[model samples]
Target: MDVREIPHTEATEATEATEATEATQATGAAHAAAADATAAALARVRGAARAGHPRALAWRTERLTALRALLTERQDDLAAALHSDLRKPRSEVDNAEVGFTLREIDHALRHLPGWLAPEPVAAAALGRLPPGAAATTRYEPLGTVLVIGPWNFPVQLLLVPVVGALAAGNTVVVKPSELAPATSALFASLLPAYLGADTVAVVEGGPEETAALLAERFDHVFYTGNGTVGRAVMRAAAAHLTPVTLELGGKCPVFVDRDVDLAAVAARLARAKFANAGQTCVAPDHVLTDPGTGRRLTAELARAVEERFGPDPAASEHYGRIVNEHHFDRLVALLDSGRVVLGGRHDRADRYLAPTVLANVAPDAPAMREEVFGPILPVVHVAGVDEAIALVNGGDRPLALYAFTGDEAARRRLADETRSGAVNFGLPFAHLGVPELPFGGVGESGFGAYHGHHSFAAFSHRRARLDVPIGAA
Candidate 1:
């Protein structure tokens, strides 16, 4: 039929109906394809697990060694992939992504034997057992597990957990974030070569593919991203009674006391907050301080930003662009929430946002309404430490709480009073580097924790074993 010859409304309706039908068909096909891919990946990993391929300490060590090789041998390839996806500088690629994962692997390799060892329970602790009886707790793998990565810090966050899963003697299905396409592709292409295609598989796609993957049962599902999607993953996991470890983000707060080195504080805060163009999950979301300290610190922060990025941050090689336009626009809108004391410039085509600082931001300001996962830093004036603590206590618990104060009393107060995943005194985000410390959030941020020994524990089932002499008792 010639649509031009037909009535305008009728022609338009007919075209719309046809377009809608085609769209529905395309969506269905995509889902079907995703299901097929997921099924194949799961089957491979499950087969490996069932065959007890991953149960051997030697097998686990070999896989870990291969992962280390991937990081070390392909350092340039990984750096280039990360730069393509995030515009991440080579130094950051080394320090945060490649080197970070390498360190995690090294730690796991060094400690895997001890982590897997069974612990004997004393007879007295067991309340007196029969002669020749023994009791112990053994760490066992949870079989095939799924790891879902976030776009930010794609390499480290995704592989670090996988290191733990493998160290604990389990096969893994890795889902690298589709947002970081280059890195994702790199993982899909390289992981098979290094870790083998059967046990550790990389599945790449957006939410649809993820949903398809979640439909199948897994021993464990570890997701790192926002809370909204974390809830959805939990719901899907519930279908099969599958366990999940959600590493989510929230508005991490920074509290500045009246007495302290404001310049030093500003310098540290600027480094921590503006790194990765402030897309960090543990970045300071807002600054809470007295009006006097807020004024002085704001000025110091301006100086720090200038010193770090020079006159124009957009031209600085070390400075990063927003991950995408959506985040850039969201960060741009936040500039209006308060007076822009520093760095309000942006270029949409380049996806560049200067390290922005907003002063006199009210409690109800738009920027304070949610997790500002960008280069925008908001300074909220408060009466004092007490008021700041009250304000923080009143809201949903943050992932991290930072206080730069020499006053031991104030520091203790913040540490004792605040309900957060972690408390940092004098600096922010440093705890993440310490592998001994458990990294995860409470309340809205996240539930499960993982890092170092904690990672091995997260993917392991600690079973209690008891052997008694039936005749001896």
Candidate 2:
């Protein structure tokens, strides 16, 4: 049975227009509903904060325990989600993402009691209060905090900040990146069950949803992503006069010394550079060394990639795939920027790119100019340590600086001269694992540090108080 369509008339056209308007109205209403839902959730968390539930040590500990359980009990689920979202290897997922966050939680739990105590401070001599005056500072929670996680390291970046915000006795609203949908959905589903709806809530969506969440006032806003989005977060936060911690990424540099073990250095560089397909914030963005060392290091790097990921890294179980096709294409275009030393293979369909090393790369090349957040390492030739220092100082300070040297003078010079978030002697990206050390960046790379006590301090406001004997004066 075939039926022919009626000829176009004013009445029929008007009916079609009315239907389109209704559909548009329905979409707007749905969006309004979603925004209202987010607003309502945020209001609940804010109410919880005002009630002082999170201020109790017992309450903080209970939440931390639940977070540990979530990681330990449902790790397989998280790993699978990460694999689906970013093609992250199971082993890498366990160590880099899950284990790293667990360590942070453990550290926070152990030190939270001491961290919560009020700290004594010496009274200022210039502005004397009285004859017998005592002063101290108390760490108070900054109400509800908004934690916006990046697509790279979705779980760790999102949850780690929550650990700090919670430990500091603040409720948190987590917005997981929509790019990693599987992980984001996993978090949105699992977090409420573990942390409770009132303490920690997960909101999932893209830029529009993020903008909606940002519209509301928060005590603090912690964002982990590229500088562009970091700036946007800062701009939004400014509307509320809210404090923010921008954990951003840039072209982190590595300086290779001629005296160091080339083989071991190459192996370590490969491990750090290619881990999670080089989507790490502190991954060695480029290598700086003398021409002679560069030649030897280049060959050793080629051997290291083959040894670790095997000749055909695409087939290797240890190697990870790029996050998405857009990133894969961006990485493919970078190969043309410099002479490929070892790896130049890429499969956009599989989102697989080999651990590539480019040598004799110009300083102004695209890979060098931008943060090459992929498994691509570019080696730039420098005259000596002085030249390397000059080059590093020329750009915006990076999140981390890696200098491989046994020389005391060189180490001291590099330590005193350069500006970066953290400095590692031989290894790169190792500073993040240590709970004692603060992880963050300087200048354009980012601002504010957080890990153990730093995390506690970052989320808490230190309010000063003074008590004086009025009768004495």
Candidate 3:
């Protein structure tokens, strides 16, 4: 299908129509059937919050273990589905989505009990006035959580938080992105089969179904995607006062210091930057390298592009498509903003853009101003490290900030001065592998973290209790 940008009026109506259709088609049956199914599950969540039930928590954990097993057995199938939906290659999918989150589930399963254990807190002096008292902090599940996954990596985004909610002992209602319709349907079909339909349900639809879902009260909400839709999700979530974890995207910046290895940097950065066709939330949207070094980095990246994507990505199948032409055109427009140093070829039919590198670009150029999610790299030359930091911080807060430097001092300074969802010193995208590290964004990028303890925390609430037998006070 030739991709035409939907005008606001049409897009709004279409989204509404899709939502209405989804509610009428899927949600009606789901809501009617849920009276018995989710009620008891929801009661467990409530009891977990008020009375703190160990058995209920254990049951949720057991369900998680079973689901993790299902996720593990179907790794290849999940990877293939992701590939079919987003054109993600197997290796990248393994490294980025499948292996990463699967490993996360394994880690969570092994330690979830310890995490759920009530934390002991030192008692205040009031307790010691007559007798010493010990305090324990309780972690309880939010009754029901709404998780909205994005199209970029539908499975991981959806499953990752599901892991967290399960660990925290909450029932989840997942709304996968309609953009990746096949994966959405596959997930809807497979989840109910692998796990019970009552515990975890998938309501697949576009905006209106989402609006209705958002209209209802959820104890917590998790969303992953662009800032625009993120705002809408946040707005809807606000109506219910539902606490949300927004995992949105922004223009993640890469600062290449003058004192670094060009070839090694190219190898590491090229892999991270272009993986998944640069649609990654933390992918380097633009590069800020030192004077002359920017040009050198650009040239090196251009060479790396050829090394990575070959002379002609249009004819290559190893490289993935633009997912859709809307993104294809957005990337092509960035190409027009600057001098193309390396590759600039677009085949709309295939949704292919040659691993493109643009240079001599103004700082405010569309190539620099926007988040170039395709295989496009823009190089901006700066006078010094200060200028680079200024350039980086000048933009809205980004999800990820990458600084490449052998100078430990510069690296630390960059870390201190720059604020993002996460910061990496070297070896690009290394944070993705940190099992303990939380992945998320700040300001416009996103609001919450996932992958480790961060995920569990996002799905659960900390409720303080004054249980001094009602007399100690």
lDDT of 2 by residue, 179-235 (tens): 999999999889988989898888988999999888889999999999998999999
Which regions of candidate 1 are displaced past 4 Å? 1-34
Tens-digit per-residue lDDT, 124-196, candidate 3: 6345534445566777877778788988888777888888887887777788998888788888877767766
Candidate 1, after superposition: displacement of residue 45 in Å? Answer: 0.6
Highest TM-score: give the candidate number.
2
> In lDDT terms, how accurate is model 2?
0.90
Error of 2 at 137 (Å): 1.3
Give every collision pair in model 3: 19-208, 19-209
Local error of candidate 2 at residue 115 (angstroms): 0.6
| lDDT measured at residue 221 in model 1 versus the true structure, 0 to 100 | 98
TM-score, candidate 2, is 0.95
Alpha-carbon runs more than 4 Å astray in model 2: 1-5, 8-23, 123-132
